[model samples]
Target chain A: GAGVSQTPSNKVTEKGKYVELRCDPISGHTALYWYRQSLGQGPEFLIYFQGTGAADDSGLPNDRFFAVRPEGSVSTLKIQRTERGDSAVYLCASSYTSTGELFFGEGSRLTVL
Target chain B: AQSVTQLDSHVSVSEGTPVLLRCNYSSSYSPSLFWYVQHPNKGLQLLLKYTSAATLVKGINGFEAEFKKSETSFHLTKPSAHMSDAAEYFCVVSLPSGTYKYIFGTGTRLKVLA
Candidate 1:
């Protein structure tokens, strides 16, 4: 696609199981971000990567949530021992520069049962 | 520390009527502000942005916002509300610059009635 792409549009898993969500950003984008959005709430910043390096991860809720962008193009959000509260839409966005406009993907909706 | 606050959790307006969504921010320095709209099951799209330039910033879809330094406010407004305008709006604040960190408000759900 011409824009950011996310895999597994919807995923449902049992509680305590681990899940991994993938995101493919636009070509040549150096900045990528991850956010989690619950019902009736705005997206909360989780992590940000600047060319394969996590510049800031202050928004990550806890150690249970982690994200990696090895090549700086595709990033994956990993959640361990997923709890019911982990259910939400995981959004990914990218930009050519750190301060440029952002382009977001449709987001991967994860449901922890 | 910096943060953005959305005044209304939800705003309802009649078709063709004027619409307003209030947003406020707290920053130690002059921060960059933005308003983004998210339709049902869609990604957020930027409506407008204020980067210490013009106070009144015009954006797509006939939406605009004013950046007030003294009041520390950035409110989104539209002259006429359309039914299709019903969506969730988010106010974001990015401090300093050269970073992807953004503080997002709780968001405001706009309901346009016909």
Candidate 2:
């Protein structure tokens, strides 16, 4: 698709399980971002990748949450030992440049039971 | 540290009436501000942005916002509200320097009534 694409639109997993969410950004976009949105709250920044390097990962909740953009095109967010509180919509966005307006994906909904 | 604050959590307006959604930001220097709208089960869409070129920014769907530096605000407005305008609105801010990560405000749910 032309817009950002996210896989596993919806995932249900038990606590302590591992999960990975994938995001395919628009072609040629160099800046990609990951955000987590909980119910009744705003999307929280998770990580940002510029090209193949992670420019910032300050917002990751803990060591259990990690993301990687190996080729600067597709990125994946990994969660280890997921907890019930980890349930939220994981949103992926990309921009032509770091300061440009972002184009977002429909988001991957993760439910931890 | 930069942050965005959306004043209203919920707003209800009748059809054809004016609509207002307030947003405020805290930044040491000039920042890039934006307003985005999200429909049910849809991705966030940009309504407009303020990049220091003009204070009054016009956006799609008859939406517009004005940047007030002294007041530190960027409020979204529309002359006449339509049923289609009902959605969740988010205010975002990105610093010109540094990480350039967008900071989003808690969304405001707009309800357009008949």
Candidate 3:
């Protein structure tokens, strides 16, 4: 893909339901990142992947949130039990190097009702 | 620890007037700063970045930012505002530490009046 690609541009789910958001990074990119942006707020870091391993997941808020990049190309963000507060736009970005400029996706707007 | 602060939550400017959006940051080491813009219904776009090599950094859409280490600031400025420039801007800070996580500011909404 010419840019990072995210699946299900919009997702509406009931509270307490499980949901999965996918991200497909640019070709050959070594780093991927996930962020959440609430309405009218800046993006908040969620997790970062260096290759296939999650190098940083400190920003995952709680244990219910998990993300994985098995083959280092596509990644999935899973929320075990969604809450109303989880409603936000989930953004995915990829970079050739960890310190390089990031290319963002259109993002998946999650609405937990 | 690293963090970014956007001084103004909202700024209004008439078209063709100068535009200024203030930002400040705190970092323990030499930091990399960036400015990102978000237009309605669009993905976030990189406006500019300061990587310690230059104090002034130019970006797309005629936007620019200056890195001021002393003041811990990286403020975005445009000589002239355009109606298309009305959008939300965010200031970001990244430390070179092994993690490479970026800290983003709250964001500033720029309103360009015709």
Off by over 4 Å in 2: B97-99
lDDT tens digits, residue span B1-114, model 2: 889999999999999999999999999978899999999999999999889888999999999999999999999999999999999999999885334688899999999999
lDDT of 3 by residue, B3-112 (tens): 88899999999999999999999888988888999888778889988887879999998999999989999999999999999999999888873336888899999999
Task: Supply DockQ values for each candidate.
Answer: 0.75, 0.69, 0.64
The candidate maximizing TM-score is: 2
Compute the DockQ of candidate 3: 0.64
Candidate 1 lDDT tens digits, A74-98: 9999999999999999999999999
Model 1 Cα lDDT, one tens digit per residue, B1-114: 888999999999999999999999998988999999999988889898888888999999999999999999999999999999999999999887435678789999999998
The per-prediction CA RMSD against the true structure, in angstroms, equals: 1.1, 1.2, 1.3
Distance (Å) between predicted and true CA of B57, model 3?
Answer: 1.1
TM-score of 2: 0.97
- Provide the DockQ value for model 1: 0.75
lDDT of 3 at B86: 96
- Where is model 1 chain A poorest over a 10-residue stretch in terms of lDDT? A39-48
Model 3 alpha-carbon drift over 4 Å, by segment: B97-99
**lDDT for each residue of candidate 2 in A1-113, tens digit (9 for 90 to 100):** 59999998999999999999999999999999999999999999999999999999999999999898988899999999999999999999999998788999999999999
Which one wins on DockQ? 1
